[model samples]
Target: MKGRTKLTGLVIFRGDPGYEAARKNWDPHTDRFPKVFVFAQRTQDVSNAIKWARENKVPIRPRSGRHSLEVNLSQVNGGLVIDTTKLNQIKLNKKAGTVVVGTGNRVGRIANTLAKQGFIAPFGDSPTVGIGGITPGGGIGPLQRSIGLISDNLLALEMVDAKGKVIRANSKCNSDLLWATRGGGGGNFGVYTKYKFKVHPAPAKATVYRITWPWAQFEEVLKAWQRWAPFVNNKLGSELSIGPKKGGNVSMEGLFLGSKTEALRLLKPVTSVGTPTSSIIRLLPYTEAVKFLLPPDPILTQRESNQFSSGFGRKPFTNKAIKAMRQFLENVEGQFAGFFFLNWGGAVSRKSPRSTAFYWRDAQFYVEWNSSWLKPSAAPRNIAIVRQTRRKLQPYIVGSYINVPDQGIKNSGPVYYGANFPRLRRVKAKYDPKNIFNNPQSIPPANHKR
Candidate 1:
């Protein structure tokens, strides 16, 4: 492995120009530099990278999207990166409501392509996010409650393990592999190349709504909305995003899945909370509604958004919790922070948690606190805010969605996976006993040494 030809499949060493861009994800706060990167175009390429790194006794860090907040990439400083963005390929069987896509494929491409066939994959909130990272990590979105988490639709997977063996896993084959990949989160096992998943007949037409609440009513609306959210009908979905408004005000951003007429009827409690300064709700294609919550256009956003770890609440946030949220909001500077409450409980939780590796099966609400700032100097404060919020909400968290990982700083594996920790650890021990795939928040094997 001394010269260029000595290494395997599409290697780029320390000086390669592509190495810089290939090493980083979208999170601007991280500063990681791996020894080399393999712009793998096929499974063999991924295998080669893994084999080379392991033989040399170097750790391997896998990156798919630009969304990983944790420093998973940073660990590759003297190791290797199996860059799979080039392995993108989508094999669709539209009639069967199924798709076999390369893990590198983004949510936007999947959604747009599926739209043509009158079917659609549950795209991640961001168009740029890669399926490799999201599908395995348990994705959430407007369509999540309506259809289900992206992992719920996963039917099979093609993976390259730490041993560099190419294996295909499905229910009839490697069922344990399928279960671990669904929600065990990334880097706990190996690199996933492709995924076989179930798609849904998307609504021919859909609707979206945007409502802004006045700053003065933040406390009242925050508490009441959480209570009203879990009780809403299965077909309807709403999110109460609380953020500082212009001129030091506060706002609530929402998304609903129905016509203006029906949406109004369903959102009466929300409308009654505060006199919306700006109210806009209208019908559109299912595609359009999906895009509403995740606009491509840049708006006022936190620059250095910190880690977002989430958990499910059994009931609406209590008065004490609501007051704490309000107090936190009161302290956050208008320019750089916000707390988001995505309402849940729909067709999603109707199924048992045991159905998938994802443990938050009975959760009614999802909470994410993000601190957004424009400068590099802002990261410490942002990270602190996220930590404080997690401490405050610890009691209310029943189970967690793995994708929104807080890296390696959590109290214990039990804090993240609830009752599923023991099982997940067992699965880790069984499949990745060598611990070839590990990062900050990954599940350690039963016989873990460090």
Candidate 2:
């Protein structure tokens, strides 16, 4: 392990020329330096890294896109980092309606690559998000309402477990592992190497729409959206973002798996509530539509920093809760703060809670409280805004979304897994009893506490 000449992938030690660059995370806020960085080129390299860490009595962290909000969960000081970004390989079984993707593949790349072959898989809005991180946490995207979460379509996957053993999980074998992976979130069971997902034929064409209302009308819009978006139509998926009233605005945007006319007809309820300041509606090919939904940092080649907390709403917001939300948006101390409501019903609710580890299947929509800052001194105020908003909406929300990891949350085990927490603990004990794959928020073994 000293020279790393026998390792398949390049290994960098502290003070190495490239170590500084390799240790940085996608989030600028995450400042952690590992003793060694392994840019794993193949599945075997991941196993080697884990084995090396165990032998050396050093902790190890597995990383792919490096987008975890709680960055420390995927990184540790003076430990070993197993980076799987170089394991990117995609194989398509077009006839079987399936695609095998490497864990390092990004969401945007996955969409574009599969669309070319007239097939696609459900993925989140961020083009830079790694399939490895999102799939295990229940990937929600534009097509989610119509099809289902990315986890719902996961057919099989390969992983390097805590014992350095490569294992495959699917319906026929290691089914319990498969059940735990779907919506159980990452950094729990093991390091995922590859995922084979059941794909659907790309929609010939899709429509996208964006509508904005003045800050003064934010309350009205929120009320209407909460009552409508989730149940609007199976073919339409939408999200509402309401920025701080102090220098921010409110907007709604989403994609529809139908023609422009159909999208317009279904959007009448939203458009009728208030006169929008601006509106843009377009019909484009499936791939183009998917690309349009990409986040600000589409490729994630650069670092972005932010803080946020998310939860699921089983029912519409109460009038009191809506007022609290409006008051918080209007009076929040920070300027770069907002609340997001993402549609979350249709096919998502069709599955029972126990079918998969994803616990909030019956939720109508999910809520995310977000805040950002430019300086360390400015972080606390912005962070407070997010926590306060969560407190305001606490009574109306259920479990939290594991995808948006939040360190501020207490009782994370129950909040993230709900009734499935117990089963997830069992899975953790089975595959990672020694807790080689772990983090502050990671699922613990049968009797351990968070």
Candidate 3:
């Protein structure tokens, strides 16, 4: 146990006073009882923890924001958890139009902080997700079409490799590593310490709107939204949702980076579909729009048992695809079950597929479904519903999103990375040939066989 003396930061063993609290993740379904948790306060601490885990032959899992949705991704039984939540830091350089941020910061804090300085960076929907995990997974949200993905803005990063060595990657040095990390997913390469991003100034005012329709109009509204959202003005980003018959309705909410008049004109296609039950549109400052578009800051310790799966839509849904969606909504039985959709293209499609590890650049829209329950006994039924729905829509969807992972996927490499899977494997082999950083679906070295 000589390596134990070498570990630094706040170490909590299994039987320690805070072990009970330290073992939890955002989703109760993914929680595990790890042997120890090392809250790394600095990059050196992360390097020390990785070396200690190797010396003791213990598995290692890197954690930030505690928001990993899948089991064993951020915590493992009888293993070590290296947490980077303490590495939170934000530095903005107005002259250079860039920002260097610690990977430990949450999405909400970064958005709020940047908005205060009259700047904006791409962000996902949930404010609680860590930048460390999201950036590598091709972060997408309301600002995606306008500013590109969070990964696209990533200019450089610092990481601690499997051999407990610190490394830097950017356009000039370790450039291939930088390319792969942009959208290759987290915990596959190494423990990222910091990210240097190219940021943009926020618009003076933006328009935010929310429109809803009766349950019966779900199919009509969906068809209209799918056709219009992706082709609408690039400055406008929209999301559509449909839920079960028991508690959900068809709704669309979004942000338009312009005056309300321009937003209404561009929204004519979908907004003109059916008689809407309600409509709310307002012009607000950029910061206010951020608050309106994103969900409220989350309670980190709040937990729920849930199953989620996602795919990219290369084109508008066919009639059969729409029918299948209707059937799922009509039959699903859960208080928290539904489908979520976001328009793709615009700046996202401007980048070639091979330019980065995120190869779904041609996707016209992105769709995902989730089933959640509070009771342990309800897990099977809820999980089955999502799996079944995925199968029915498989023909129409191209690939799955790594961020919204589904354990049911047997061969996940191609499903998540597409044609870029081979290149990613080569990069993995070069930096982590020993395969020290891995999870259930993590990329394996090219020399190793599945």
Candidate 4:
């Protein structure tokens, strides 16, 4: 452990003052006990930590927003954790239509910052989710229908490899590395320090709508949405949330890229469905519209004991799939359980599967099944419900979203990356030959021993 003794740069061990707080992640299911935690403040710190882990023969994991659904991927028991939460710095170049953001910057902060400057970038809905994790995992947010995935907008990145070498990847240099980072999944590559993204002009005024129906109408609403949302205008991004089982409601919320008048006109067919309990639509400045999407309190998301699984719908939801979903909801005993569908098409589908490292271009919409429990005893049942829901829809869905990692996926390489896995392995071999940066689900080198 000579290397461990030599390690420096704001290291925190077992009984350190902030050790308890620092070890916690967004998901409560992950209970890891690392021997050491390093709060890296600069690119040099990240490099040094990697070198120390290698020399000391200790496993390591780099953590940012700590939002990985597969908790073990970000926490290595009895190993070392290199935290990049202090590297938050942002610079926006409006003239170039690009922005460089530090690894620690959260999605909400990034969105609000860009909105004020009359620009915006596609990112996740959560305000506290970090850019470091989302960018590489193929961020699909409300604006994806128009602009594309956050990975699609990534222009460049800087990272520290397993050997403690700082490298920059972009169109001009290390182009392969840049391609892999786009959607290869986070914590698989080296520790990311910064990302430069192409931003789009903020619309003059946008429409935000939230339409809801009683729980009894979930089927009718879902059927219409499964067919309509995917083929709807490219300028619109819509999502459906059906949940909490017995007493929950079914709702559809979306954003339109044009005036409120046009948005409503386009949504006429959808709105004309069964009696909606509530229909609220409004037009606001681009900045205001963006703000409306933020969850009331992101901190609550971290405290929820939840399991999230995802799948891609390549075709319309079949009658059997719909029936399965209804039965699943009817039998729910958990305090909270739901399914969410995010529209996928337009700009997202316009790109070929090989265009970037992300490979799910043929999906109609992405489906997320989530279940939450209040006590430890309720976990097994809730988890079973979530898994069963995924199983029922397996025949109709293709692949899963990397961002919403599911522990049930025995072999995620094919599901998450599809045909892009081999290329990702090559990139892993080239950049991290020693396999110093790795996890349970990280991309393995072409000749990896493990």
- Local distance difference test, each candidate: 0.73, 0.84, 0.89, 0.85
Q: Which stretches of candidate 4 lie over 4 Å from their true place?
A: 4-9, 296-301, 333-336
Best lDDT among the predictions, by candidate number = 3
lDDT of 2 by residue, 1-450 (tens): 553324458899899899877876666676588888888888898888888888787888878787777767667898888888888899999888888989988877888888777786776757788889999998887678988999999999999998779999999999999999999998789999999999898888899898999888887888888888888888898988898888888899998988999999988888888779999889989878877787446344343357889989888888888887887777654454678888988899899998999989999898887776657776777677778778878899988999997878887988998999999999999999888788888888986655
TM-score of 3: 0.97
Off by over 4 Å in 1: 2-10, 73-75, 245-257, 297-305, 334-336, 408-411
lDDT of 4 by residue, 1-450 (tens): 676435656899878888887778777777588988988888888888888888888898888887767767778788888887888888999889999999988888889889888897776667878788999999998799899999999999999988888999999999999899888999887999999999999987889999999888888888888878888889899888898666788888879988889989888777888899999899989888888876544562454578889989988798999888888778765455788899999999999998899999989999998887667787788778878888888999999889898888777787899999999999999998867777777778888864
Regions more than 4 Å wrong, model 2:
1-7, 295-304, 331-336
Q: Estimate each model's TM-score.
A: 0.92, 0.95, 0.97, 0.96
Q: Give the per-residue Cα lDDT of candidate 4 at 375.
A: 78
- TM value for model 2: 0.95
Error of 1 at 115 (Å): 1.8
- The residue-by-residue lDDT of candidate 1 on 92-175, one tens digit each, is 886787999988777777877787677857865577777888887777776777888788889999999888889899999888
RMSD of each: 2.7, 2.1, 1.3, 1.6
Please give the RMSD of candidate 3 to the true structure.
1.3
Over 4 Å off, model 3: 2-5
Per-residue lDDT tens digits for candidate 3, residues 1-450, read 755538899999999999998987888889999989999899999999999999998999998888887788999899899999889999999999999999888888898889889998777778889998999999988888988999999999999999999999999999999999888999998999999999999998899999998878888888888888889989899998887787888889989999999999988888898888899899999899888877686576654677899999988899898888877788776665788999998999999999999999999999998887788998888888889888999999998989888988988999999999999999999999999998899999998986
Error (Å) of candidate 4 at residue 401 is 0.6
